[model samples]
Target: MIEGGALVKNGHIQQQLNQQVPDASDWLALSLLPRLGAGRLKQWHHERRAWPQQWLEALSVPQRHYFLYLRHPQGHGQVLQPMLDWCTAESSRALLHPDHPAWPALLNELPDPPLVLWAWGNLACLEQPAIAIVGSRHPSSAGRHHAQAFARALAEAGSCIVSGMALGIDAQAHEGALSAEGATIAVVGSGLDHTYPRQHRSLQQRILNAGGLLLSEHPPATEARPAFFPRRNRIITGLSRGVLVVEAALRSGSLISARLALEQNRDVFALPGALEASLSAGCHALIRQGATLVTTPTDIIEELGGPWRASSIQGAENRPACREGGERQRAGHDPQAQRWLVLLRDGAVSLDELVLRSGCSVSDTLNALLALELAGQVVMCGNGWTLSAPSSESGAQTR
Candidate 1:
């Protein structure tokens, strides 16, 4: 991982973590070594299984000299102490070594796997089956629609949505998964604490609040830089079983992720865009290069050897907005909230009752209700939550 300028391998690292031994500190110190990238980290691990001890003695002369410099007070204070303090925030953050259950096995397939992965939010989302949806940072409305629709279908079918958390396609995908009450992982280019694109800070928090995850190779304090993004792309592709390019210009980073996906032996799926649109050029190129042309979530699930869960896919279909209080629900409102509105139409119900009726967590139910309320489709009274106004005979919910 790029966090704090170090590399961390999985197996032996896990042993040190479990023992709560000083070796863990040694691992952190090793990661802080100047210019020590994943390739050299792997080499060091192979040559000496016992790291930070025999591991140091086995280092080449230059590496050992560099390590000696970092061992000094100035170097240690500057490079390692911050990471130690950041990792100590155990409630909101964690460092994932190779052996951590949250670690993705697909990352091991990379020629240069991250030595350690820095993560914030629910770590369990890492273990779920994932599909990456990426495209231009500035997308056409149609492109945004496809990204959201496909992500929702995949998420409903029990797949975790993964993306770079960029503005256009990535944000739509994350919103789609969250709307479905599904897991999403945002692989950020900057440190967990330094949210890039600043606008997405709310989105990042929502991901955490909804039991999703935010991941970074950089440590908590690392600022976002252009160079860090390509590195972030690799992790986005690495954690996924397949990658879907919703839209991209010829020079887009989404194409970079698609290329990396192919390199990592992950399936690459691209949605066809307009013939003349520049945004479609990269996706078209990928299709020409043998990427699967996909129009729906089943194309991904089937290609990745996952079951075709018809029921789950059915749950993601869009429904019409309900007109309540003689006011139409906002356009593009979440369909999931309409399901909750149906439950609330009869009368106010307790949060527990909503959970029971909807089979969703209290957090998810509350989030849906909040969205509905914000859209003026539902009201929360002393009784609990109820439709803000009576629904038509057909019973549609706005948001």
Candidate 2:
């Protein structure tokens, strides 16, 4: 058995983990071939329900030669084997095909939807109604605040927040959703194994633990580059019902996501910032171009007809209530637990944050957290801690 009580090495589940679906191996192989893009592969997928090997006979002589050359041992080892191993991670990861039930139907609206998606964390999040919040990598303070605020509110109201998991506004948006105990999906440019902006490693782990998801069109271990990021933006917009630009420069990548959203016929929303702020330039331009000018989460929710509402108490307030939960029975009575709990009262707090805020040794803080968990005062959310919902408030006022 694996650490999570999963029998990952035997029976039907093991079989599924070890094997790709019928013709999936061929699809994987074809993806590595030159000149065979997603659109072309999609065409082949619909026209011929067989492996790429079946099409070699129908190709022109030059194409057939190139296809055969790709079957060389070096190519097989370089591409097919790695992807096959990637698919075997079981519950922790998945490679979804268009035929996979877990695949997001919204992606079909893309003119060139990815033929395969490498996903990590909870695949079920794909089924949730999602809203994308994207913006500059170096947003102003107010921009960051607005992004996080809207994300928390919308998430608490039952919309899955989607972003690129980049540094500035994207990270804040993801953090907000996780804090609200709501689903968030990160569409990354790099492979899952090679998370970009390495500083976000802990954040990425937290996202998965919080029941969010990480999606990539790139294969496992692929290095991220400039070209990959723009492609990643499309998926961010494609996955959502609407896109909200908190802040962006006139030439920023966030604008790319908004443009893709509009092309996909998804609602586009932008927050208007001070006219003098350079970060607001792209957003102002977007508003001029007819993107909805959003002042609150409700603006986005109403425009997209999502489940979000303004009055909901998100973050810790939205946690699932238990029989022993309620306001009367206070948590964090002890000095150490109190230190950590205070931070999480507003939102999720990671161990590092607890250590920094509490000024406690890491070991002591971890012990305190474990004790709190045992006492049902705090629960692990993603890579952080949050207050457990009380029994008195069993009926949550969430959408």
Candidate 3:
């Protein structure tokens, strides 16, 4: 398997991550090399494998010279040092090698995937189904609402909302997902160490605290730039199954993401606006060009199937948000939550009692409870579980 380093030759690749790795500094150095895009590096690495160390030896004379310059004291370790220090300083901060378990494998579907990802917060979020919501940096009021509402609904439906954490619609999307206690990921242009809008500094912390992720291909301390944002749009689309455009002018970056999504064979969804709304023009044009027209979360959800179609927490508003990221991760996509509720028809029951009633393991019984609790289908009542608010008479629950 390409992921596991067992070559399955259809022009196969082996990821020898566990064998031996280059110095963190060296890997970073390779990434920063001039004229070396991630696409070329990945193709080369897969063609011949020993790890990044060998790749350095294989570089052209000039590339090698530049690599040495990065290591030189005068050449400004400014970019590398802060990035490395941040990763070293915190257990949560990580430079995710392509072979890392937490890497967003969906990105690999892209023509050119990132070599590594600078990730902050729960890496588990990367494995979840994600829908990218992108739009104009200066969206209209309605556009902002659409971005947030759709994001919240999609998140509640168990799809992570992916976006660039910019000033307008992107930020709103992140906030909406947070509001629903749903997972979200921000594929940012700026390095993980700094915020672009600066206004979003607090929003950044809230994402980490809420189990969402902040990701960057750039090293830490790399501030935002106009060119960086567009380059990073590919990553935002690459990580998602679909890209949603809430509102965008013809010239907007959100449109670029949609284009990349199409090129990557990912679904593109657009929320069409009024005939006269300039911001809606991009979305309308996209729809005319065969992008899916989405009016509600259900439209996007039904289009992007799999786990997204699975029964999840009921209403976004009713459920108590998961208090911890780990607990939420474990609770995801558990079809057994409904089955657990059937066993609890008699009334409130302790974990031991539920285990006895359902003839399941203690671990299973506990997991069911957490899922139900998160769904607002059940609540903890004095160390036991019972059905929660708006008591259903039919006793049926959404998956």
Highest TM-score model number: 1
Clashing residue pairs for model 2: 210-382, 325-390, 325-391, 326-390
Local distance difference test, per candidate?
Answer: 0.74, 0.72, 0.74
- Of the two candidates 2 and 3, the one with more favorable TM-score, higher being better, is 3
Q: Which stretches of candidate 3 lie over 4 Å from their true place?
A: 1-23, 51-54, 68-82, 310-399
Clashes of each: 5, 4, 3
lDDT for 181 in candidate 2 is 82
Error of 2 at 346 (Å): 25
Weakest lDDT window of 10 consecutive positions for candidate 2: 1-10
lDDT of 2: 0.72
User: Please, what are the lDDT tens digits per residue for candidate 2 over residues 1-399?
Assistant: 112121222243234334333345544555555665677656665675344334554454555444443444455566577776876866678888787788899987788888788899998899889999999999765566567767876887789999999999999899879867899999999988997899999999999999999999888879999999988888999998899999999999989889999999999999887778788899999999999998766667666663555444323232222112222222234343444455667767876777788776553454455445544566655446677775112212210
| Estimated TM-score for each candidate | 0.73, 0.70, 0.71
Candidate 3: give the clashing pairs: 5-15, 311-399, 312-399
- Per-residue lDDT tens digits for candidate 3, residues 24-132, read 5656777888877777777765676566446655676677666655654444355568667888898788988765777677777777887778988888898788999
The 10 consecutive residues of candidate 3 with the worst lDDT sum are 1-10
